[model samples]
Target: MRTLAAIVLICTATAPQAHPHIFIDTGLTAIVDDAGALQAVKVTWAYDAFYSLLITEDYGLDPDGNAVLTPDEEAQLRGFDMQWIEGFDGDLVARLDGGSLELSRPRDVTLVMREGRLVTTHVRDVAGTPAMAGHILSMKPFDPTYYTSYDVTMNVRVQGLEGCAIVRNLPDLDAGMQQLQGALTKLGRDQDAIEEGFPEVGEAFATEVEITCADR
Candidate 1:
C-alpha cells in the first residue's frame, strides 16, 4: 500500500501574533532547573521551516489583518476560543476513540543545542492537535504547560491522517501507539520526544506537527 510521511507542520514565523502562538525550531538547547516549588526549564530554539498552518485562527484580529478566509474556513474559525490553545477537551477526547492516544504534563521543557546543531526548542505549555482527525483518532496530547511553546514529537493515528497514510509508505497506526507511550513519559518528566513524521507543507495530510527542541 502507498503511504506518505505523517505528522506535517505548516507554521510560519512572523511578528508576535495577537492570538496566542508559539515558536517552533530545531536550533535550541535547554537547561533543567527548578523554579522554587515548580520545575523550571530554559530553552534555545531553531525555527527554519518555511511555512506553518494554524490549527486554529487568530480571532483577536479582524478580517483585514488576518490572511483572509473562505466561507468554509471562516466557519471553522467562527466558534471556539480560536487561539493556539484547544477550545475544549472534546477535541482531544473525540480522537481517543479510534486509535491509541495519550497526553501528559511534564515538569518542564527547554531548548538545547550541544556542540554545534540547529536551534531546537521544546513544546512548553502546549497541547497536541489532530493532524487528520477524519483519518486517525488519538493524538499526542497538547499540554497547557506548553500551550505557547513547540514540540519535536507529534502524535498521529487519527482518522484525518488516513489520506497521507494511504498515499505513502507511512508507518502503520501500530507505530502511532508506540509514539503515544513515549509522550506519556515526557509529560511530567524533564525528557524530550522527537517523534518523526512528515512536515505539513506539500501534502494535505501534513497538518499535525511536533516541533523539536534543541540548541543552536
Candidate 2:
C-alpha cells in the first residue's frame, strides 16, 4: 500500500508540474491601421518576473497623425511594478495598467501624456490605498556599441516608494531571484529572446533595461 500511495501522489502532482508557465490573458493584440502602423497594442499579462512579456508588437507610424517621437526615442518600451512583484514578497501587482487590461480592482490610474512627456497618477499598491509615486524617469537606448537584441532599455527613477525606503536596485539580481511569485510560466529572463523576436514585446529598444537614480 505504501508504493500505491507514492504512485498516487506522483500522478496528482504530475499534471500541474508538467505545464509550462507561459501565461496568456485578456489583452493580447496589436491593432494596425491601413498603413500597417500599430495603432493600439495590448496584452493579457501575468506578473512573475522571469523575463515575461505582456502583449507586445511592432510599432509604426499612425495614419490618424504622425506618431511624434522624440529624437531620443529608441526601439523598446519598459514598465516596472507589474510583474516585478516576484522580486518582492507580500507585495502584489497593482494599479497603472488600467483600462484595456481587465482587472479585479475597481480603481483607475490617470496617465498624462503631453507633447513628449508622460506622467502617471492614481497608481497605488495592491496591498494598500495610496498613490504609488512622486518618481520621475527617462529612458533611452542602453548602448550604442552594438545593435543585436530587442531588450527593453529602461531608466527607473524611484522617488517615493511604499515605505519611503531607499529606492534602489538590489545589487544582486540572481541572489534575489527567488523573491518572485507567479504562475511559474513567468519566472525567468531570456536575453536572447529580448534580442530575437517577441510576438508581444517589440524590437530591441536598447541593450538592457537600465535603472537610474541619485541613490535615494
Candidate 3:
C-alpha cells in the first residue's frame, strides 16, 4: 500500500497534470485577537472520498476502517508537511484593501480522518492586520497549474466575530469554457501532451470569497 506522502509526490512529479486529479472542499475562518482585530486565517481542506480512500489504503487502514488516526499515525500524518516551493506564494490567494497580502507559511498544521474523509488544517497569519472597519478582504484557493481543484464547503463559518459575513462568487462559465477551448486548440490533437503542457496555460479558475465586516 502506498502512503499518503507518496500520493502527493506522484502528483507533483507529473508535470502539466490535468486539472483536478485531487478534489478538496476548502473552508476559511478568520481569527481575531482580543481587540477584535483580525489575526490570521484558518484554512481547512477536506479531501474527497476517492482520494481519502487512496490515502487510507496507502496507510494500511482497513476497507471498513472509519479513518480514525492513532497518536503515532497522527504525528506521521502531520509530519508530511505540505509547504509550497520556495518563493511560491502558495495556493491560498488573498487581498486586503485591494492589495495582495503576503501570507506566511501555514503553522499549526494538523491532519485527521473524519467520517472516512481526510481533513487537513493550518493557520496563515495576515502579514499585518490593519484597522479594517470598512475594508473588504477577498480570498480564493487555486492552483495556477490546475492540478488540484478547491471548493468551499457550504458550512463555511466565521469565528471570533459577529458582524462578519462571507460572500462567495460563482465560477464564470463562459470564461471557463473559453479557457478550455483555448487549451484544447493549443494542444492541437496531441492528447498525450494535454497533461504535460496544460500547466503553462495558467489560471485554473476559482470561486472567490469576499469577507466583509461591518464598521466596528
Candidate 4:
C-alpha cells in the first residue's frame, strides 16, 4: 500500500509548500449498459516519472533488471487494492442527485509502464443506485488533505453516449491554494491539520465532473 510517509521519505518535502509530492494525470470514462443507463466509472491514473520510480522500487517490480514484469510481478501489480479509507471516504467522490454514490472496491485493475511512467487502469461500480437514466451525476478525484495532486490534461470522455455532451468544471488552482493556506493557518502546526480541514476544504481543489443526461 502507498502511504504518505513513503512519499515523504522519497521526496523529502511535505507541508508548508504543499507542492504535490505525487502527480497523476487522470482520465474518467462513464460506463454505460446496452440500454444507455450509466453503470460504472472507469478511471485511469498515470503517475509521474518521479513517483513511478518510487512505486517501482517499493513493489520490487522488474527484479530481473530487464524492465519486464514476470508473471508474479504482474499478479502483484494487478492486485493493488484501493478501497475507501473508512470515515475519510475514498479519493474519488461521485454523487447522483442529492445522495452520494457508493463505489465498490476497484475491479479490473491493471498496471503497466508507459514511456517510463506507471499507468494504472481500474473500474468502480456506482453502488447504491446504478441506473442513472435521467439524473445528473457529479464526480471528482482528489485528496482532501491536498496531499497528492491530480491533473487532467486531455478531454474527459463519455462512452456509449452518442448524443449526450460532457461539461467539465476545472478546478481553480490559485483560489484553491489560497483556501489551503487559510486552512493551514487556522489549524496551525497541529499534527492533524490537513486531515482535519480536508472534508470541508478539499473539494474546492478538485476538478468537477457534471454529466448532463440527454433528454428523455
Highest lDDT: give the candidate number: 3
Among residues 3 or more apart in sequence or in different chains, the pairs in candidate 4 whose N, CA or C atoms overlap within 3 Å are none
**Candidate 2 local accuracy as lDDT?**
0.25
How far residue 25's Cα lies from its native spot in candidate 1, in Å, is 7.8
- The runs of at least 3 residues in candidate 2 whose Cα sits more than 4 Å from the true structure, single-residue gaps closed, are 1-61, 64-66, 69-106, 112-122, 125-165, 169-171, 174-216
Off by over 4 Å in 3: 1-17, 59-68, 79-81, 188-196, 200-204
Q: Give the clash count for each candidate.
A: 82, 15, 1, 0
TM-score, candidate number 1: 0.21
lDDT (0 to 1) per candidate: 0.27, 0.25, 0.67, 0.67
Report the alpha-carbon TM-score of model 2 versus the true structure: 0.21
Model 1 lDDT per residue over 1-216, tens place: 012121111121121111113343312111122221111112333322212223222343224434444445444543232123444431221222354333332323332222222232232322343233223221222223222223323222111112233111223434433343333433333322223221221111112322221221
lDDT at position 76, candidate 4: 76
Model 3 lDDT per residue over 6-85, tens place: 34335434323334567778888877675667688888888877788787688675446666666676666663537577
Stretches of candidate 4 off by over 4 Å are: 1-19, 63-72, 81-88, 128-130, 186-200
Using TM-score as the yardstick, the better of models 1 and 2 is: 2
lDDT of 4 by residue, 46-135 (tens): 877777766667887776655556556666766453544666554788887757888777788888777767778888887643565577
What does the lDDT come to for candidate 3?
0.67
Total clashes for model 2 = 15
Measured with C-alpha atoms, the lDDT of residue 118 in candidate 1 is 22
